[model samples]
Target chain A: MITVDATGLSCPEPVMLAKKAAKDNPADEIQVLVDNATARDNIVRMSRGVSRTASVQESGGVYTITLARP
Target chain B: MESVTKERVILIVCGIAFAVVAIALAAMGNPKNMAICIACFIRDTAGSMQLHTAAPVQYFRPEIVGIILGALLMALGTKEFKASAGSSPFTRFVLGFCVMVGCLVFLGCPLRMVLRMSAGDLNAWVALIGFAAGIFTGVMFLKGGFSLGKAAPTRTMTEGFVFPVVALVLFILSLVTTLFVASAEGPGSMHAPVIVSLIGGLVFGALAQRARLCFAGGLRDTFLIRDASGLITVGILFVGMLIYNLVTGGFNVGFAEQPIAHSEALWNILGMYVVGFGATLMGGCPLRQLVLAGQGSGDSAISIIGLLVGAAFAHNFGLASSAAGTTPNGQIACIACIIVLFAIALLNLRKQSA
Candidate 1:
């Protein structure tokens, strides 16, 4: 699994980071860390576009989303 | 810090350049008190679409087409062109709709608010103050963690170019129609020709992109972070446009007889208040959204669509304010818009778990 931490990032950064991580490791699972709901949604939508499934877990303001190939 | 300084310098230059181009365009046939207003042009376009039967204002604007095409070229050259969408599209639509409703009530966007003030409309002062106040409210929401989510990337570039393509088609249609139909009287007849407007738009677009200039962002940042870099550009634009207007004898100094504006002070302030608040919440003003859309932001594109539809609704339902003043229905719509926007903001506010 490839881990990309985008905590505290806003708008396009979190989505951009998650996209980079997923594209770089197509065969592995990708985990993205974000602090806002928008980033979480963006990552989830991006993952879905690539035919992957995404799940989200929240703790405090931090959100952890994992995307994996199905 | 260096990056910030560079950004500020670029913004200042762009603001000054915009003022100069606006004055020149006005001298060359663009309407008095308005050289480049995205909202006004969209309002005109809305008329052309028969969404509103406002006869004198209907025309296909070349400046808008130029803004999109200019930005497209710059993006392509810099390889920043990427088509993407995934943001909460429906929410953006609603936001855009609210934005237009608010702006039409005020008779201008944030950019035009400043421009109107520069032209000596004391009414614009009220609107500007209201805009700042509304942005302040939006800053409060941001501090409490309000967001609209991010946009996902798309594989097809065609999706990204949809707005630009439509703009191109409109440009073609404008040319074809000119052969058979004369331009409408008043504002529609006054234009700087397609080439001049396009060039002006290109210059403005490039400078704005480099500086990240946004009137709504300026107010939002001032309230949220106490940063004044963005506000400085706004200040310069106001002063510059004011001076230019005076030199050109365009300064009117009153609410009465202002082009495309009404004398209704309360609704004017309230209208901009809604626009300021909604734009601040959505992260940018209408002009800023257009620029962002040009930069391949799907959320902004959705917002633009909302703006178009909102303009349609406003005219169709007789909700748009006029030079005489806002209709009773327009006033009612303004009140309803405020309540709805505030409700949305309240619902989106982050709550502490007790």
Candidate 2:
């Protein structure tokens, strides 16, 4: 599992980090943490391009998105 | 200190500084309620270069120069500059141009919108409502996977030096004074002292760079994430401005006779609606764009070019509004920009195919 913590980073930063995670761990499940919805949504969209399905869990404004290869 | 606390403190400091700088610039002579307006200053700078022949609004503004240079220097000192580009260059340019049209229609960018509203301009209030509505709409687009794509990192640093170099040239020209055209009368002619304005811009630019303070993104995050971090800073700035205005007897709440503003409710609303939408599409406000350009983003530099050209275009084509009211040409341009914005938004959307 590749876990990417994107809390506190703004848009495009989080998205870029998520992209890097996917690139480096091509066949692994990626778990991403973000503090906002926009970054979460952007990461989820990026996951789709990599053929990964994303499941999100939220608590206290923090979102954990797990992207798994289908 | 915790990271969160540190970030919040930086934001608060930046906000307070902005309030102080805006007021101080005005006191030192940058037209009343006109301090720190990115669009207006760019327009004036364009006029000074004879990019447009507007007689009353021609002046080489040093604040613009100071801002870009300040951001560039801070980013460099902190080793945060990473020059890159290639994310929908033309689309970003159009969005930049369209946003400037919207700003001219309303006579202010987001920063000046706050300034005008704090000083009791009802037109700005109307524009605020439209800005919020537009942000909400941009949120809908985001939900549907709207993005400008990723910018690839460049190998060389030369691309990132563009805006900084421009700022340096402008700084020297501003000090030389006679090198550029100066406005004889009107809003363009009114200005604070060159050194004072540059200092204000430098302070504002450095703080804003550190905090990533953005007026439009604050609104965008408000609608998109239910996060108010960005808005909190703007709120702080507002309260600061409000307090200063009230204490100094500058506050006069009314629908008429506000300085540098018009009362056409619909255009004011639509104008900012376009601004909010375009800023969202491009990511960041006009001020943010300048900072990003200084940070070595060539894409943002292209956008800034569009802003300067758009400012010239608005004045040359009579598509900018005045204190009297919205011009017929300006009204048409606003509507056209809105249509073009919708088109860009729809065209750039990437649909996922499984």
Highest lDDT scorer: 2
lDDT values of the candidates?
0.75, 0.83
- Per TM-score, the best of the predicted structures is 2
Candidate 2 lDDT, B1-354, residue by residue in tens: 124577678788888888999989998999988988999999999999899999998988888877787788887876667677888888889989999999999999999999989988888999999888776777677656677776755678888897689778876876676767888999998999888999998888877777677888888766764456777678888889889899999999988999989999999999999999998888888998988888788888888888899999999999999988989999999999989988888887777421
Any residue pairs clashing in model 2, and if so which? none
Off by over 4 Å in 1: A1-70, B1-4, B177-183, B350-354
TM-score of chain B of each: 0.93, 0.97
Per-residue alpha-carbon lDDT of candidate 1 for residues B91-155, written as tens digits (9 for 90 to 100)? 77888898898888888888888888999888888898778888888777766656665555566
Alpha carbon deviation, residue B227, candidate 2 (Å): 1.6
DockQ of 1: 0.04
**Candidate 1 TM-score to native:** 0.81
- Tell me the tens digit of each residue's lDDT in model 2 across A1-70: 9888877444855765677788788889999988644466567656666778888988754789998989
Model 1: pairs clashing at backbone N, Cα or C within 3 Å:
A38-B149
Give me the displacement of residue B182 in model 2, in angstroms: 1.1
